[model samples]
Structure formats: C-alpha cells, structure tokens
Target: MKRIESSKAGGSQFIPGYVQATDYSDLESFMVAKLKVTGQLDMQIDSDFQNVDGAVSNAVVPELWTGIRDDVRGVYIGEFAFWYSDYISFIAESPNGQFTSDEEREIIEILSSFRTEN
Candidate 1:
C-alpha cells in the first residue's frame, strides 16, 4: 500500500499507511445488515476542498463527512474532520438501532487509535 502523509502550518499532521478503499458500499451494506436496521439505508460519504494556511503558503485540505441514513435515525453518529489533503472516514453502526452517547464515544476512540505519523 502507498503511504499517505499531510502536514499543516500549526504542526497538525496525518500520515496513515493503510490502503484506502475506493468504494465503501459493501462495508456499509454489511454494517446495515449487522445492525438489523429496517428498510433500505444509504451511506453518504463525501469531501470538499478548503483553503488553509500551511508552512509556506495556503494549502488545500479535504474536509470529509460520513454518515448513514440520518433521516431514518434520529441521532446521527458519524465523523467529520479536516485532515491534510486526504479525507478519512471510519464508519460504524450501532446494533441498537440508534447510537447512544456512549456508543458514539466508543466509536470515536476506536477511530482515533488508528492515527499515525510519518
């Protein structure tokens, strides 16, 4: 897998070695099945470019937003962040229909553990 790295002016950085999947539809489907949510569910994952001050000049950062069927579920437990030019989204579904506050915290912890530096 190719290594990806990004750094910001304030020393904020992200360097992950894991291979990013081009398509996450299958993963979403699996999670929906595991969670046993009724009806069809759609996963929304996208990124937008934003200008940010870097070490030398203004740099573009990809802001990522990821979530699953927020309309069907009342509380949306998803991730949104701005990381060096790469957008990363770790999707998780709660088996109890909707993610509780505790479950959201746990998911955030799990995703944060994968952070790495080059």
Candidate 2:
C-alpha cells in the first residue's frame, strides 16, 4: 500500500504522519471487526474541528494495535483516527513507542483543526 500524502514532525525524534485514502460501507462495523479480531482496545472521540464544515462527526482511536509493535515489550505507541461519514478518516500511529502524551494530544489537535472538503 502507498500513502496518499504524509509529513514528518519535530521533537527528540520524528513524529511522522500521513493522510490515507480509505473506503468502507460502514466504518463502525469495520473498526469493531478489526478490534475484535485483534482483541485490542479502541475509542470514539469528538474532533476540535467538528464545528467546521467537512469535519468528522465520528472519530475512532484504535490504540497501538494497527501497526507493528511488541505488546509484550510494553511499547508506548500512540494512534488516532477520525472518521468523516463512513469512508473518510485521518489515521496516525507511533509504532516506535516514542510518542509522549503531549505529542499525542498535539497530533490529535492538529488533525481536528483541519477541515476537509470531502
């Protein structure tokens, strides 16, 4: 798979991110199935840009299970996903276990501040 777009950020190490194009008939169901199959924890959240046009209404934070991480090693990975309608969303993850809480929030806020056209 290839990313539609991506960006790398600052800090002790890079807090990289990307915009991925995805399609799904039902996002909730798809996420639920993914979480179930993997038996991992995830959550739904509101975006800071929800009031803006084209902002996401339903957002999902699919914990640190979407990428390659050593759960047994207790890697500190952070991930976020915002779903607009059922097919569009922003997904982020730090599989290197290098993201701090502040960085995670920073990522989320940046994600929510952007208004998508579709």
Candidate 3:
C-alpha cells in the first residue's frame, strides 16, 4: 500500500489509505469487484475523467472508506481505473475538513506516482 499525508498548513487531514494494484481478467470484472468493495454496487457512476494514461471512473457514496490503518467515515471520493488489466483504486478523503487547493494538488501528485506504463 502507498500512503500520502496532507501538509499541516493545508487545512485538511487524511488517513493513509491502501493504494491497491490488483490484476483482473477484464475491466468488467474489475469494476464489479471495485464497486462491491467500495460499497457502490448500487450506485451509478457520477463522473468519468481522462488521466495521464487510462481513464478514471468515480462514484460518490456516503459510506465508510477503510484504509490500511484507519477508516474514513463520511462522504469520500472513491476513484478507480483499469490499466493493462491491472485494477487500481484508492479513497481520497479529508477528515479535518474540505481539502484546500494545495491539498488537492498534493493528493493528485501522490496518486500519479502510482501510475505505470502499460
């Protein structure tokens, strides 16, 4: 698992989450499993965005996001993607409050570091 922390001055707090890199047979299976694990199986996809490489799919649900060391209990940002048959997912959360601009940038940088060439 990979971890990233918000800066003290960023006005946000985030628990270190489990950055998952899983191998799946196909994207459909990966999506199904991801939705199940993230408690979004019954939720519809609300956003889709293009990343540096693959596309990212997201669903916002009021569910508890469990990480390696902590559980963020609130509305959290759940993002997932499939690259070269590898499934990736992570919960981007702010426990203290809303994320500031700096916090958002830092979070993106941390997530981007997990990207790999197909």
For candidate 3, which ten residues in a row score worst on lDDT? 29-38
Residue 35 accuracy (lDDT) in model 1: 20
Q: Scored by CA lDDT, what does every candidate get? A: 0.29, 0.30, 0.30
TM-score of every model versus the real structure: 0.28, 0.27, 0.28
How far is 113's C-alpha from truth in model 1 (Å)?
Answer: 2.3
The list of candidate 2 runs beyond 4 A from truth reads 1-86
Residue 64, model 1, lDDT: 23
Q: Stretches of candidate 1 above 4 Å error?
A: 1-62, 66-89
| Candidate 1: C-alpha lDDT | 0.29
Clashing residue pairs in candidate 2 are none
lDDT of 2 by residue, 1-118 (tens): 1111111221111122333644432322222101111123222442221211111111233232233221212211222233443333444445552346676657656544444334
Per-residue CA lDDT of model 1 for 7-91, tens digit only, reads: 2211112233334534332222111111222233224432322222211111222222122222332322222223323544433
Model 2 worst lDDT window (10 residues): 29-38
> How many clashing residue pairs appear in each of the predictions shown?
0, 0, 0
